[model samples]
Target: MIQNNAYIELMKETKQLENSVSKISLRLKTDQQLIQAFLDGNKESIGILVERYQRQLYFLCLRILQDHEDSLELVQKTFIQVMEKLYTLQNHNSFKTWLYRIALNLCHNFLREKQNYNKALSHLSLESSGSFNDPVIQEEQSLLLKEFLEELTEKQRNAILLRIYHNLSYQEIAEIMDCQEVTVRSHFHLGLKKLAGKLKKCGLTL
Candidate 1:
């Protein structure tokens, strides 16, 4: 039954959203401590850092990528990339931003590749059987919000994610995103416009 199926889907999505919120709220920044340990050339620190960021990070990457293996691979690749670039940790203060940038870049690349593959598979199935589909769209509002986010520019997408998901400040976002405060502001505006347009297109509005 459509009703039963929708109900089941709603329950699953609710559970996933609750878990994601709890995961992200956990002490997010073991960044500096990890950096200190990493700078000392202790490989264990790299593992520790990955453990600290793995949850919300997977959530973040998962949002942008395929629902199944992409998140797992991105999280692992993010850690590996950080380990290889460990010597570049100029300031422990910027570790969170730095780690995010690396992860973000990887997510974008994965999304690009995934999109190409998705196109090839579109004729095979209109339903998204890929694991990379949005996982947080439980309620009507949450579903709408996810749709709005999908319409955002990449920069806007990252800005909103950093602000809401990662809980980074504007200054911190600027540093991680490698942009000025004004550009951060601009991205927010552009992102908002795009989201609003999508809402209008979807016959939904904030």
Candidate 2:
């Protein structure tokens, strides 16, 4: 009986050690490493990758779609698509940008089908206004910024949002946008110039 109890305790300790080692291995894995692991038939690695990026992708979709339900749906669809097409991905290091590209393409297609530009702007305006805590000054500033954003072309707005809100570099933005770096720079700078002009008119500086 004592030997039996000792064997059970040893088994428990071994299991605990295995769990700790698994967790440490997961923590040490980079995105590319996770992707490779998934490709190598470790199904759980894909779930880890999803957990790492799902929140960021959801917010990116929400900012573009401006609807919670749509954003949620898009995030699910994005992951599904990623899982289905991951094998075709040539550059594992570009997984993040590739993921964003998929999500953005889905957003663009949805927006195009809806064809409700004015409705989207209205939603954006409301979101902007609600973001401010100060009832007076912040509200006014938000409204002004919303108006400036409304005037920008789609490419210009996207470039500005990706750069400012996401803190993405020009090269990364270009990769996600599937555009030239120079084009992204032009759109961003032109958008900024327009914003500056609008802010100057209101005695504010960007």
Candidate 3:
């Protein structure tokens, strides 16, 4: 009995040490490094990669899908697709952009299948009115902004969302959208112009 108890304690300590080492190693590696590790048959590296971007991907899906449960499901699907296709990615350094592209494509497909283009903008509150401390005023502004966003073209709305919410550059957005950088700028500017006109008509400026 004493020998069995000692062996169990030793096994527990070994597992704890292994877990600690894995976490530290994961933290020290970049996304590219982790991807390479996974490609080299280290399956544990993929978990770290998922942990790194799961939340951001979730919100990205949520913004486009406008459904909490659907967003969660899409995030899982996105990672599964990534796992299957990771071996085919040529530019490992662009994994973030590639991951986003996959998620966006999935979102677009979901939207098309559901025929639901009117994505809710509640998660995308306008930042121009930071002075509005009143919750009622904030809600009103959010609804107005949401309506305006819904009016814009899908490309325009996506460009604006990627730029503003994700803080991606025009080049990055272009890569994800599979469009030219100038085209992205054009869509964003045109969207903003239309939104500005609508806001101005309502005695608001953005």
Candidate 4:
């Protein structure tokens, strides 16, 4: 009986060790390693990168496009473009910022095309997709505020989206946007001020 208890303890310790190693491996897997794997013709790493970023990318696109179908389509195209340009990426650590830059440029292009075709939205028509009730009014308020943010100047719009929608800090936004952090902060503050004014005039306030 004593030997059986000792054997059980040993097995438990081995299982715990294996679990710990697995966790550490995932955490330790950097973008650099993943990029190297891709360069070495490992397709699985590319898939892992897509899995890691798909949701975040989707949300970012949705914030800009405000249409679920269009957002998903844009994200799919972004991933495809990323794959095509994988060889051109120099610094693996810059992948996130690079991806944001690409997606943002694509959105700008799309907006430009839409403008040419005279299909640009006025930003006030972007309604959250659900029945409005007293309970969810607070949540709707924030989304509407974000929608109003799209009306700001391009720099302010990008700064607000990067900071508020994507939850990036001013430093990260500056890096992705190729501007100084002070510029990003200035844009965000001014953008918020303009957004508040617009919302107040429209009779929509949280």
Candidate 5:
């Protein structure tokens, strides 16, 4: 009876050790490893990818859609599309840009179907006018900035958001926007110049 109890304790220790090692291995896995695991029928690998990028993707979608519920749905759609077509991804190193491209496409399709250009401007106008816990001057300046953004075209708005708000490089924005690098630079520069003029006209300095 004493030997049997000792043997059971040994087996339990071995199982615990195995579990600990498994967890450590998972934590150490690189992006490529995770992608390979996902391709090899490991659903948890996809979950890890989602967990890593969900917040940034959500904000990106939110800024584009300007509607919380729609943004959330778009993010989910982006992930679903990624999962479905992940095998088509030839370069794992470009995963982040590829993911952004997917999300941007979804947003563009959604906006096209809804023809919500006016609606988006209206929403931004309403959103910017809301009360904030900042000083009156700061709040007014922010409101003016949003109004300036509202005046820009969709391409200009997207270029400004991706480059300024999200800090994406021009090349990355070009990839995500499906445009040339020079085009991305042009859009960004033109958008900034327009915004600056608007701000100057309103007596607000950025």
Candidate 6:
């Protein structure tokens, strides 16, 4: 029974991957175009959207959850929500930030449920301490940055992640976080200061 279930799951994943590839072959130029296609019942349009944002969303979730499987699960859920709610997105230009809001909300729920923020941070600190020989320094920098970010309060961390990693404006972050632009700026600057001080103690510079 377990074998049959596993086989079924594998086939489902394979079919999804093939469908994704077929959609991606269209090479849609803009997110708005993709959304229109999706609204017009072109399911492949969503495949394109997922392909574009999945990596960044995955890393964003990883930085928050500090768990691979949890991040993957949240990314999947984010996309599912995006597909379901695509009709409600009024401003196509804001789709990226809107998608981010979905992810951040999901991450918030997951973190609240686990109530293990400190534990997650500690685990990331330990993980970051062990590696210096990674070939991709950019990736290493991102991991180290995430480890440092874990030291922050959730609001500060989210602000910094959206501002830095995602290149979101403070106004956009405020909208996503349901906070004021001033609050977003405060969280981002304070988070950066805290992270800088911590890194300085470790003889590292931001």
Best by lDDT: 3
**lDDT comparison, 1 vs 2, better candidate:** 2
The candidate that achieves the highest TM-score relative to the unseen native structure: 3
Backbone clashes, each candidate: 4, 0, 0, 0, 0, 0
Better of 1 and 3 by TM-score: 3
State TM-scores per candidate: 0.66, 0.83, 0.91, 0.70, 0.79, 0.70
With a 3 Å backbone cut-off (N, CA, C), the pairs that clash in candidate 6 are none
Off by over 4 Å in 6: 1-25, 124-151, 197-205
* Ten contiguous residues with the weakest lDDT in model 2: 123-132
Q: For residues 1-206, could you state the per-residue lDDT of candidate 3 as single tens digits?
A: 99999999999999999999988898689999999999999988999999999999998998787789999999999999999999999998789889999999999888888876564443444455446677776676677888888788889988998898999999889989999999999999999999889987987666
Q: What local lDDT score does residue 160 receive in model 5, on the 0 to 100 scale? A: 78
Query: On residues 1-206, what C-alpha lDDT tens digit does candidate 6 reach at each position?
Result: 99999999999999999877776565645899889888988887788788889999998888778889999999999999998899999999889889999998998788888888666654542223324565465355546666677668879877866877678889999989888999999998898889768766765546
Winner of 1 and 3 under lDDT: 3
Alpha-carbon shift of residue 88 in model 3 (angstroms): 1.3
**Which structure is stronger by TM-score: 5 or 6?**
5
Note the Cα lDDT for every prediction shown. 0.68, 0.84, 0.86, 0.74, 0.80, 0.80
Cα lDDT for residue 76, model 5?
Answer: 97
TM-score, prediction 5 = 0.79
Which residue pairs in candidate 5 have backbone atoms (N, alpha carbon, C) closer than 3 angstroms, thus clashing? none
lDDT of 5 by residue, 73-185 (tens): 99999999989999999988778889988998898789879998566654453233223456776677677777777777778877877877678998888888888999988
Error of 1 at 172 (Å): 2.1
Candidate 2 residue runs with Cα over 4 Å from true position: 1-24, 125-135
Clashing pairs in 3: none
